[model samples]
Target chain A: MIGAERVGAAAAEPSEAIRLEGVRKAFGGDEVLRGIDLSVATHEVICLIGASGSGKSTMLRCVNLLEPVDGGRILLWGEDITSPAVDVNAVRRQIGIVFQSFNLFPHMSVLRNVTLAPIRVLRMSRREADVRADELLGRFGLADKRDDYPDRLSGGQQQRVAIVRALAMQPRIMLLDEVTSALDPELVAEVLNVIRELAQAGMTMLIATHEMGFARDIASRVCFLDQGVILEQGPPQRIFTEPREERTRRFLQSIIEAGRM
Target chain B: MLGGGRAVVVSTVSTIVFFGLIAAAFLFAPGSAQVRQEFFNLHDMKVALVGDPSHGVFSVGEAFLRNIEMFLIGEVLILALALLIAVVRQLRGPVFFPLRLVAIAYTDFFRGVPLILVIYTIGFGIPALGLRVVSTQSAEVYGLAALVLSYSAYVSEVYRAGIESVHESQTAAARSLGLSQWQALRFVVLPQAVRRVIPPLLNDFISLQKDTALVAILGTVIEANRAAQIYSSYAFNYSSFVLAALMFLVLTVPLARFTDHLIARDRRRRQAGGGR
Candidate 1:
């Protein structure tokens, strides 16, 4: 059920799916993500919300070790996944990421985009990869698009296909970097519907989205990041209804007004 | 200025056509000249230089064409083999850089000098080493080696350029799809690059054909330009030079047109991209 009530006002909640400790990252002289601490637990969909340059996307990327952190540690299932000796590629295979731009390989069919990682990295046979890819496509309501190229699909369809591609990896957790932000208003619902299903299935997901409804309805906890720091973290009702920080309240109000339209 | 340009065009065309017709008529003439003399009379006092085959001839005939074909085909085969080997080495990661360096030095040294010098050095000078490029150990084989070595250098660079022009992005996308760097380069990049380089490759081939003439200075056993000069000298008739020039044109002109067609197709693709 889509919750209409204010979320930031909800009571305190505690669980951890992912944990970060003093995770610091800098690019050249400009720091993107400062020292940060966070925790997420199994079957908990955490939505990261913040203004531009808040480094919400950077935090999600670091979870997969796609971008190495300069300082600090990241733990996946309490395993120090950030260690240099860890097979980073093997770790990345277990955690899937979907980009905001829907970076589906343009040259391949939707099925190919989905099945490639499994066959190549995981050493799954083509037949098995194809079967899993088709099932995931069907799950996302994109089965009809299995033979189609990304360019041939609509924005909504492409986004669904991108989700299906990540799910085809059978990832333990999915990091969505503003999946619906690029969609037309009418098309956003279709993509959100697919995500809602994933959340219902108890898949661990860290979503960076401006869609407050998804954050409220799907995420067990919402953390508001501002300027590379978490402003406030709590249940959706607590963050939305009774945010501790003035920054969180103002940010929620801006998005609430936008969300109503 | 326009009238002057028109006059230059008309006169040039007229001169070409006039000479072209004269050369064609020589082919249909009744009296065929044969190269006849004692085969080994060159070192003896028995032969006159202009009177017989031991020295040279006036009529350009089937024998000359046959000899030219033998020399050029030998050279083409050698160059083709060298290019194939270079390409395979380049495809392999540890690009035979030392061999490439030596090949480049050989090409530069040969291409930089007059072709005649290389021919003479190979045919006359290299015998001093008691080494031969061919099992036959013939001087003509040495001359053929010079032609092949020079053409191989130019052709290798053509192949290298074609391989590099393929878009780097195409390679990257392939890598992201789980292809190794080598697989991506081989399956994606080189195919496109080869298509782009077809025109220049043909240009090198045509140039290689023309360069075969340089072997004449070595007095090789099977050589077209040498036949022309030899025949012209023996009969005291200079028209065999005209016949040899026609033979070269017959080979190059059609190839040039085919290359131009490839270039036009590449240009169309570029324009389509720009328009898009």
Candidate 2:
């Protein structure tokens, strides 16, 4: 496809951690991600806030190459990852993702869950992986749960373990897909606290979230996605308090009325 | 006191009637004479225990041992072949389409053909061809091969169902972690799938165990059923068949109960919030 060649002709943007150009994705006839352009700079936390089915999650997924784009190129540090020539696993190694459901490997112990990709894919020795896993678990207050299965942990603890699992790979960027969405209200803060720490530590992150206050606090930029397009994007203050588009205004109004913002 | 006493009397009368009818049938029924003699006579039971000497060389114990040997060999092959076929069927992407189609055809052909016919062909036909290696093997080997061939088709279907039952989200989660599709299956999907279908897999094993009786048709190996056939033909008493039936029950009933116990235990664990 010319998609790959066109991406090569585009000049490299070294400062961008991730770049999506005219990214289009569809599930059969239903186009989920229409033409979109977004750039995430190094160590910048970009929060995607929109209603369900607005393609916020899809965009994050595309960045990690979890979902292939139909017509666009996603560049990871200036390499065209969406090209057919790219080794997906190599690209994915630089980008870690955590899901909403806390999709921890249920059959593995908490320690193994964190160490699996490292030990298997990254070829880290078992002893080294265990040490790294223990350190991450200890830092997240999950040290006591190292031997426990995913089901044994509380929702908040499971989410933290999931984040640890992704972090063990030492990826360049982290994609958090509504990480707190599956958790109970009280459990949300524990997970948000972990993300807050990661942001404070200057980890590059692309987060899809409904946690408005979190977006306000953490995001360098907030992008409002509506029907597979970015309707407006700017500093969190501008997007949240002074949205440029009517659709963005109505969405924020509903969120405010629902006491969610 | 009279109302309570009447209920007690009714229960006692029902128990007595049930046992009374069983006793009367065993003691006085016309056709029961042969059943009584064949099932319980001390003389016939002694002969059945040793098997009829003129028609077969083995005792019933030896026959039972042969059955056990075949089951052990056949079961191992069945498990391996079934899993191989299941994996083949589960192959995805266009590159594997031909192999997948072949696996589909293999299951359909074997599942549709009668197990007895498969045994007859492989048991007799393969040796009749007089080729090298396979032809030189004993009819008993052929019988075991046929058992594996037929049972693998059934077991592979069971494995397929188990694999399919695993949620797509699990695969997605695995893929999101940068695991290859095969790695995802090996580490995440198959374990859960296999756990979910243990009861059904055991059910298929039970059927495979019973079907081992068909091997007697080869006439080259005298297993439990073959011993019963020899005894029934030579001794003119069906007690040997009854003995064989009891032996199968002795093997299968406990397995069935064990499956039930496992299902109950799994349910309890899930209810206790150990669910994944």
Candidate 3:
């Protein structure tokens, strides 16, 4: 449903869904994302796998304009989003992000959480939003939990509800930042399965995750980051099995040694 | 049966000891009867409390009624004004720098100024200047305004604490959803912040109710303490003041109990994870 209204000039330049040119971010003296360049094509799934603090989350945040980049530009549908003059809220409407902690509005019911942006930002009729929300909840096996608050749901159910919330926005792209990292080992699969279903539906997404096996199974492209740079990136098969960079190999080797992959 | 009889004897002895000490202090101590005749005249006390229409211009009861009136007005205004102050204090961008400074200055000025001084300045000083807008209003309005101004500073600080206590991740999540800064604050942050501060806010309101007596200093409004002053001066006894104290206690005790219940409920809800 996204980009449905764009019938004119801008729709023609839909080559890159999101492109980062020399993006750099820092906190105080610590550099988080440094001169990184990446492009996500329409319907492409890119998974960023790396050690903690390697800038994967920072990159996703920058693309959403959640974090101000210290340098460089981010282009969303060929528009420079990093420019100070850009309307951030308008740009953010196209990209929905889910955090590791499943930050559902604890005060709101699951249905309200899913329907809020549509009703408020998009100015959609409540009836329409509710219809869409009910469909999403039913598909996600959360229909019974619709009236329940976030705290009343399990971690996996909450995460699924959060994903459904993003889907209700009909966003062009979704950024998932280690969405399963905070879940218990047993609960991780339930959330990962939802992400897999989204990937199957050909949704464009940029995911930062520690689940190497799941990344290999679903990613169209896998990027292995070291420090603040993407040290190696390629088809998931090659990156996971025959990595070209030493850092990538060593990282995967550590993962293998830790028995996480 | 033997143990129960022993417990009853112990309880009766304790009660006798407590009452005996109180009677000795109030009725039978050396010079206590004369003291009582002067300050504990039951007939005079009743007349001052409810007021003798024939005897005084304003009875302690009328004064107490005025105090409650001021308190009710102050309570509603303080909530809105304090929340505005707290949000202004939290403004982050360079554009709001001047507003931020003004908010900080306001809190500092009001928090530092004594309540009575604020009542005097706004209550008496404003009226004396004969400003068309405010001068025509009664002193009670000015007194209510002073209480609101003074209490908002304290209440704002309490609100600020609640706002800061919400984790940064909450704001990030709200913003990530495309909610604007003010919208996020209104729909997400402030609701939680306000909930967390309700008990403390009620505590501040209790103090606000007590401070209403200070409004009597404006001289135009005869609140309960002022009635006590008038009656004591006439009778040459402090019994009227004692009567006024009883009246204030009558007003405050139920509020104190309610505050305690709210605080305890808040604690229990927190312990049980009230879906914070």
Most accurate candidate by lDDT: 3
TM-score chain B for all models: 0.66, 0.89, 0.88
* Pairs with backbone N, CA or C atoms under 3 Å apart (clashes), candidate 2: none
Q: Which stretches of candidate 3 lie over 4 Å from their true place?
A: A1-13, B1-28, B273-276
Residue lDDT tens for model 3, B118-172: 9889987887888898788988899899999999999999999999988878788
Candidate 1's residue-wise lDDT over A1-261, tens digit each?
Answer: 112111221223233557899888887887878877988776788999888689998898788775689999998877788998887666666677887777766556888878877787678999999988877787678889899877778889988988887776667678899999888889999999988888877677899998887788878899999877777899998787789998888887887777642
Q: Give each model a TM-score.
A: 0.61, 0.93, 0.93
DockQ of each: 0.13, 0.55, 0.61
Total clashing pairs for each candidate: 22, 0, 0
Model 1 lDDT tens row, B35-98: 2122222322112222255443423444345445644685567547555644654553345677
Candidate 1 — which residues are off by over 4 angstroms?
A1-17, A256-261, B1-276
lDDT tens digits, residues B1-276, model 2? Answer: 469989899989999999999999778888788786766665654676775566553466568777778888988898889988998888788999999998899999999999999999998898889898979898778888988999999999998998998878777777777778888888888888788888888888788778888999999778888887777676677777777888888988888999888899989988897756
lDDT of 2 at A142: 95
Question: What is the Cα-based lDDT of residue B17 in candidate 2?
Answer: 100
